[model samples]
Target chain A: MVEAWQWVTKHPDKLAGWTLEHIWIVSVAIAIAVVLGVALGIYISRPGKEHIADSVLYLAEIMMTVPSLALFGLLMLILGTIGLKVIGFLPAVIALVIYGQLPILRNTYIAIREVDPAMIEAGKGMGMSERQLLFKVKLPLAVPIIMAGLRNAIVLLIGITAIAAIIGAGGLGVPIFRGLRNARMDLIIIGGVSVSILALVVDGLMGRVERWVTPRGLKRR
Target chain B: MIRLDQVTKIYPDGTEAVNEVSLEVGEGELCVLLGPSGCGKTTTMKVINRIIPITKGKIYIDGTDTTKIDEDELRRNIGYAIQEIGLFPHMTVGQNIQVVPALKGWPKDKRSERAEELLELVGMNSAEFMNKYPSELSGGQRQRVGVARALGADPPILLMDEPFGAIDPITRVRLQDEFLKIEQEIKKTIIFVTHDIYEAIKMGDKIALMNEGRLVQYDTPSNLLFKPKNEFVEQFVGADRALKGLQLIRVKELMTGTPPLAKADERVVTVQARMEREGVDCLAVVDNEGKFLGWVDRVNVGKGETVRDIINRSVATATANAVLSEALSLMLSSGFKTLAIVDGINKLEGVLSFDAIQLALSEVAQRRGSE
Candidate 1:
């Protein structure tokens, strides 16, 4: 561990670059997951779309049950054949997006579903249009719940981004993968500690954001 | 006035929620749509505002077909409230009340003024509550804000579905009384829904009772009490129908002219003489200005020199506007056969005797039987 600390201090720039890269990849993937999850959740949760919701949730569940590395490898082959970036940042981000889906999508679906039906009826009865109801009532009330899902996705993806280093996406995972190759146990400990710290920081920031966006009406007395 | 002609609602799943119900609520009338749960009372009310589109009939509001008008435009003109209140949790009390007015494009100043005015109208302190969110309010307060929100536009017609159902019993009664006061001042044509028959009797000018998606009986509260259309109504109204009927009748309805009076200054012998001449056991004592002082009973005669000294001051009194049930209870609790009917100033207005109430109910029963 002391040796790894010396090594890290000796290469501060490299460590900083990998940390930024790790953050960027995780953020992009979580952002994509949030948009996709919320939109799909809203569509499936609407009244009179039960069958569509069932089928979509079932497919997402099956996708969730699959092994993450195997799924990432399969995506690499498909993207490689399609002549897209398949080896590094793109494949790694895509894998994280897929992994982040269940938390975001499931939470969004349940949150939107759990909104008081009477409130929606009142909105409709008071002459609010479909679009107005969604924006003014549904989305505002669902924000806290949805934000919680985003926080979960961010933390999960931050940790998963380490695995992406195996596919050539340089991050904190590089040290661990190098440790594995060169039999450096101290480097592996440093990499594991860095990923844990990164998850906590992302989680703490997102929690504050969630608290800020939570509807004032729903705040505990 | 709002009118529904053979309004029916059959969902896609073949559940006929409302079946060909026809009704009319006159201008300024508060009509109650009442029944047990799932009896389609709510569906019947929704059809009036076109919230639940009618499967087979026409609804007219102030002589305009509801279906013919643009739905949003039509709804904007009809106030709606429900049991759960459904106040926008994200909005403050003022913002919740201003929703309809804001939707109609009222200027900011006008909307704010209207919200304050309505909060006061519903008996809330506007300055204290305007900025508070719904969760911060008690259930009863939230219910009041719900009503204020519904009345935001001062719409001529209002639809309320068990608006007070979620409140505690004590608060529910207070809300009901407050609503009654507001109704009298505004006189908007209203269709209120409830399963509690007592609520229907208290709030409705007319009651339309439903069962199994059909209209069972539609009539005034008095008629439903004294002349139920069938056994179902009698059972639905419960065995206390006679006692409930007294609520529909007022002290003024049963009161006759004030009985012969004895002046407070009059001698005890004079009070006895008057009671004797009138063939009654008591005479109401009055002051110089004719305000009721108390009653001088025959038993109190000779107790003192004057009527004031002998007067039974603890004798219960009833107001002219008080329901007969209230007066009756006062009489029963006081062990008196008659109650003094007083005006706001405690002046003698008339007299309400137990015989009069018995006569009124019997007359209603006899009239219904003869019909």
Candidate 2:
């Protein structure tokens, strides 16, 4: 860990770029996941979604079952032959994105569906149209739960992003993977420490957000 | 005015929630739908806003064909509050309250201003609460914000579904009283749904009692208590209904202690002549301050004594919202036929008599029978 800190201090500029790119990939992918996942959750959680939602959920569950590193390899093969030039990190990101869905989709489905039926009745009684109820009441209340899912997704993605460095997606993991291959203990410690710290910081920030936004009634902590 | 004509709701699987319910709520009247679970009280409310679209019959709000209107537009015009106090956790209280107004296309300032005013109306400090998130508030406080949010756009109709159900019993009663005060001021056409018979009788101007998807009775709270529509209503409304009826009926509605009114300082004969003319045994004494000095027993009056000498200073009073039992209990204990209705300063307003109570009961009974 100390050696990793020395490495971060040793190559501040390189660390900065790697950090930025790594975070950028995680953020963009997570952002896309949130939108698509929440939309799908809402769509699936609604009444009469029994068959369709169950099928999609089954597929997501199956995808979640694949090991992350192996999934990345599969994505590499699938995308490498396509016109995609960002192939090195492509497989990594796709695997992380897929991995991120378990919590998010599960939470989204629960959040949207778990809104008190009485509250929905009240929303309707207030003369709120279906659209108003969905976007205004249902969506807002679902936010905390959705955020919960997102929090898990983001932290999971951060940790998973490090392993992608093996495919030339040289994040902080570059030193970790490269050093380990050459049996360089110092470099391995550097990459390992940086990834752990990244996960810790991201996880801490999401904890603050959850505390700030989750309804006191629903607040777990 | 809101009218439900033979409204019935049947789920897809063929369970009837509300069965042939027909009733009309007067404009600005607070009508409570009280029943046990699965009694159709909630379904009746849903049918009004078309949440669960009426499977049979029609609903008219202010005499309009409500069923023909777009559900959302209609909901925007009516305020709905729930027992869960569903204030959107993601939004500030101000934002939550501003929802309907914004959707109604009011100017931004108007929406926010109205939201603030509503917060204040529900006893929340608008400045303190407006920017704070919902998670920062206590359960009772959040419920108040929920009410403020519901009342934000000034909808003529407000629907409350066990709005205080989640709160502690003490808080529940407090919220109910606060709501009653708001109701007195706004006089909106309200449909409050509750399974608690006591609450329904306490808060409702009129109570609609339901059983097994059927409306058992629709009448004034006191009337429903004094006269149950059937064994179902009698059983549902509870055995202590006569006592509940007294609580439902207010002192003003039932009392007739019209003590002789004499100015603060007047000749002793002024009290005498008025007492003789009104045929009152006692008089309510007042001062130049308009403060109630107490009561004047005619027995204490002498041929040439000052009014002060004649007035009995030990007087009991009741406020407008004081339940009938309190005043009646006081009157019975004190051995007085009249209970003074006064404000906080103890200024005399009116008096309560058995006649008033009898009158309210008879009139409500007559009206209920006619219906």
Each model's C-alpha lDDT? 0.86, 0.78
Q: What lDDT does candidate 2 reach at residue B208?
A: 91
Q: List RMSD in Å for every model shown.
A: 6.3, 6.5
Off by over 4 Å in 2: A1-21, A24-28, A83-87, A209-221, B28-30, B89-93, B116-149, B163-187, B195-207, B219-230, B233-249, B253-318, B329-371
Candidate 1 C-alpha lDDT tens digits along A1-221:
79888988898887888899999899889889989999998988888988998888888888878777787789889998999988898899888888888888888888888889898888888888878788888888888888888898898888889989999988999888999999999779878989999999878988888878888887776
Give the Cα error of residue B142 in candidate 2, in Å.
5.4
**Candidate 2 C-alpha error for residue B309, in Å:** 22
User: In candidate 1, which residue pairs get closer than 3 Å at backbone N, Cα or C atoms, i.e. clash?
Assistant: none
lDDT per residue as tens, model 2, B36-155: 898999889877877778889999987899977887788888888876456666577888788778877899888888888898888888899898887788999988988887787888
TM-score of each: 0.82, 0.75
Q: What is the DockQ of candidate 2?
A: 0.34
Worst 10 residues of 2 chain A by lDDT: A212-221
Error of 1 at B221 (Å): 1.7
Cα miss at B168, model 1 (Å)?
A: 3.0
TM-score of chain A of each: 0.95, 0.88
**Could you say which candidate leads in DockQ?**
1
DockQ, candidate 1, vs. native dimer:
0.56
